[model samples]
Target: MTELARAAAADPAAATSPEPVPTTPDGVPRGQPVLDRLVALLDLERIEENIFRGVSPAESPVRVFGGQVAGQALVAAGRTVPEDRHVHSLHAYFIRPGDPRVPIVYEVDRIRDGRSFTTRRVVAIQHGKAIFSLSASFQLREHGLDHADAMPEVPDPESLPSFADRVSEYGARLGDMAKLPRPIDLRYVTEPAFLSRESGPRDARHQVWMRADGSLPDNDLLHVCVLAYASDMTLLDAVLVRHGVYWGLDRVIGASLDHAMWFHRPFRADEWVLYDCASPSASGGRGLATGRFFDRDGTLIATVVQEGLLRIAS
Candidate 1:
């Protein structure tokens, strides 16, 4: 077994458990448990060498979430490379909407394997056509000039109300918000961008504390992939905040155009990290946003940038 696999085996949380009903801080039962389902979502089924199949959990029926494909494609690429080489960067583009009713097939291309760095390209296919494509770079451990921006001052995660609590505050207008699968527990430090029907005087930035709802194995790849999955949850919300448009509240339509991420340090998905996000610009029906993920002690773990198509119906 690989050293990383051994580490995962050592983690007690790797053991399977019965699924539980999801609930909020106020004990309102909502949907099925999420951690196990998330694990299943990431566990791609290897069909053949360099090819893998992944399925989405039964959550939103409209379309497969973009993050799921990105994470699974990373997993497919990681399987082809050695465990010692960790992923440092990835760039991906969504070509078409994924059909959640069907499984997605990922094909990994062995682009290059160098002594110091490795490169991989992954294509996600459904309906015999490419739905998404990604290129990732991996590197061996090496020390470099260490510099990062300081984590911004914000209320501790524990001090804020859970996302479940915030959603419950919306009451019936948002429907059964708790019924949605929430694998990552998010605590907003400010009023959620979707709360108001009109744009306020607030800036086009947001901060939230998030972590996997349950413990995960010690596998480094899994942890990174999980973070990739969670990163997409609210990054684009920064753009919506600027226009005072809530996805469900207004006649707004949006889809991620592309995503890019850089891993600066090793971090666990089960631990609290603050995600600070802002939209620098929006024009010609597209909006660009950037974010920084910081650990509880103010250590920068990762940075993300994404551009998405945003249009509000007249």
Candidate 2:
């Protein structure tokens, strides 16, 4: 078995039964859609005027996914601002790995409320300690000079194999790793970052087409926050792609140190978005990656930069 398969099989709680059908807001059980589950995960329950509590889904057993906290914190920050204002940018730091068993309390601080722009700071507390922090800026819609790098021409998303298909191709090597619930439908344009355990090209740059597994509502904030959650899914893979190392296969330990994103234009999280990612540098046991999100028509929607702690065991 491949190292990844062995690692997955080592976790007794890894492979659970399929998720039960979940009822929607309309009170109809339409099955457990990945997108709906993601939306529910981000939906914070108001605890106080400025404090909201978010829970990690039972599906994630250990540490809470950093993206979930970041997205939920952004949602908390957004809730305190005017509905007309839209998030323009966000910067966040992963203070500590969150304990999934506990609920995270998000405290939103109204940093500034300007006529044209507003800013909010949020702290995610767990076990009476700050585990994450974020600062986001919002602005009213306004016209501005616009230009962006053209999206590279690549195979359409429909032409690429789904992540499950690729994993299945490995047969028994991947074991039940293939059964892990995928919230995003990812279609890799090149060899996947995790497939480096076998023979493959070592390319620092990568591209993938991704979208929510199911349709989302028409809420703009929901879409943006969903993208925020998706953004963390693959960016660090660029670093592994560079060294030809897979996370579980190569004994590589990694976690996001900080994340930043700038919204460039409007986007729909449920639509096919091309994630163009590259690792510009890796040193001191850390790697930096940048990515651009583009719509099907090649319109740049957002740009993200992240630094991660990547250590390889000898």
Q: Top lDDT: which candidate number?
A: 1
Write the residue-wise lDDT of candidate 2 on 174-252 in tens digits.
4433444667888998788777646664868978999977666666787899899999989998888888887656788
Candidate 2: worst 10 consecutive residues by lDDT? Answer: 23-32
Task: Kindly list the per-residue Cα lDDT of model 1 for residues 42-121, writing each as its tens digit.
Answer: 77888898898989876655788898899999999998888899999999999999999999999999999999999999
Q: After superposition, how far is residue 208 of candidate 2 from its true place, in Å?
A: 0.5
Count of backbone clashes for each model?
A: 0, 0
Off by over 4 Å in 1: 1-9, 18-22, 25-33, 176-178, 198-201
Those runs of model 2 whose alpha carbons end farther than 4 Å from true positions after fitting are 1-32, 170-177
Q: CA lDDT of 148 in candidate 1? A: 93
Return the TM-score for each candidate structure. Answer: 0.93, 0.88
